[model samples]
Target: MGTATLLLPPRARFGGQRLSQSTARWLGRAHQDNVEGDPVARAFDILPRGWPVAAVTRQRDAGDAAGSAWLRADPVHIRPDINGARLLAHGDALGLTVSDADALLPSLKPLFGDAGFPIDAPVPTRWYLRLPEGAELPVLAGPARALGADLFDYLPDGSQGRRWRALLSEAQVVLHNHPHNAARVAAGRTPVNSLWFWGAGRLPDHVRSNFNEMLGGDDAMQAFAEAAGATAAALPERWRTGEGHRLFDLRHVRDLALLDRDWLSPLLADLRSHELDAGTLEFGDGRRFRLERGQRWRLWRRPIQSFVEQSPAGDAPE
Candidate 1:
């Protein structure tokens, strides 16, 4: 018997009424539990040293600052509105390229250097900035939380926050007039407007995991697997025979319609054929449901309207 686990975002958005019928059915017959902690943190907990996003990702580039305080310096687009500005969306939605990154780095390097932080871009969309050791920095939110949300409330605080906020303002001004952004706008693409700082901290000394394999496109997942001495590979379209435990991250399936077509349907078929002994589904928001081969016989467990109920106002679990 083999076991597999799937990690995904919440099946539905906050206040969203439409339920994923197939997902609901799958969860209805499974043993469910609401795990506590950030999904990224939880995923890291599965690995040896746990979730050190900055350290693990920095290691991918063999960064000198891998052991130092570091943060993700990812490029982002910000749209200005009457009230204020908000993040455009995530990188995947921006269609950024290495060429874009190369063209922009030199122009902005001085600004970051002058601000006491040096930036590095090992990949097109992903960037890193090394901070002074023991520097007081705010507990900033990740890009996911600020995606499509107002930037004002999400900015840092205190004297350090003031400096960081000013740095962002200066960067935005520079990016707005940069020839690269002008060319981007001319080419009918969203301009690379600003930089987002997040996922801060140094790498952990050690890490561990229960799984033998981890399959996903997620950088953090792959990094964690590598650190934990597990076989990490790009996610495959179909499951292969394996022993021990495996984790599949499918958070890229942004909507229920695509989730059904790309993942749920195929996974359910695999379950029906007994190709798998057991499987678990985790919505990053903390809800986890486990399904075993024997549970398939529980036909009386009718599918619910939604796999997760709308979290109470101001009480939603992270």
Candidate 2:
């Protein structure tokens, strides 16, 4: 009677790679589909229709910003090798503890404070900075984009870009030689050598979503649901039966094989039993497929080969 949506990253199929058998079969059965240009952008589009809410800001404000713009100050590792420098995603910045953050805060907070941005470390990996009212902030890419890619292009840009750039440069130098990082290196762990700033915005008073419940690990999803006056929770071990539209955020799952066993198989069974009216699967690489119970009878459609098998050389699946 209602639609169930699944949002996942594009790791389902890379160039010349294929998904697990169950997932591939389900993709072939979908009745409607579209490709998005950016997986992250498309994933956000499925949320209860609202202005872009700053995730780090929402996490910091905890539903009370009192009117202030916020930016993420996520910890990161700059990997250097023959390929030069690479900024690891926040998740990949391994072994960084709260104590490490506390040790480095004194040395780093003053830099941001001097630049007029006050910093706060609610969590070790996810930090926040409060921007002055009416400050013009530059558009910066999320850590997802910076992971394993050149960081130069993803830096903040726009009116105040130069100021932010200078601050970031200074931060790198300070973090590079921090005693905490040196100790981390001594312990054979990746040192936290840089900070990432993005997702800048103020929390909106009102947000709306089609779903009655939002289930995921993402704080933004929880914050959005709270703002929209809906129920939000961490995903359960098993999906519970519900009546209204529901959104399941599975973007954190990067392994297609694991997703097939854990999610797609169960969902396929639900569809065949007519337990769900319709279901939509979104991939991180910008492709989406939708299937309804009635569409299952279209037996003429055959399961496709692995996405990698169908993809052209050096191109993503279409």
Best by lDDT: 1
Per-residue lDDT tens digits for candidate 1, residues 189-273, read 8898888878777777766777778998877778878877888899887555556688887766566665566666666667778
CA lDDT of each candidate?
Answer: 0.73, 0.68
Candidate 2 weakest ten by summed lDDT: 309-318
- Candidate 2 overall lDDT versus native: 0.68
Against the hidden reference, what TM-scores do the models get? 0.84, 0.83
lDDT of 1: 0.73
* Poorly placed runs, candidate 2 (over 4 Å): 11-26, 35-56, 59-64, 81-84, 91-95, 236-243, 309-318
Task: Give one digit per residue, the lDDT tens place, for model 2 in 1-318.
Answer: 566778777644444455666656666766544575543233333333333446424553454465778888778887766765688657434766779779888888899998889887776766778888888755677786567876666775664777877887898899898988898889888888778878777665445667777888766567667666668888865545566788888876666566666777777778778787778877676566777776666565666555433422221232
Error of model 1, residue 283, in angstroms: 1.6
Clashing pairs in 1: 47-208, 48-207, 48-208, 49-206, 49-207, 49-208
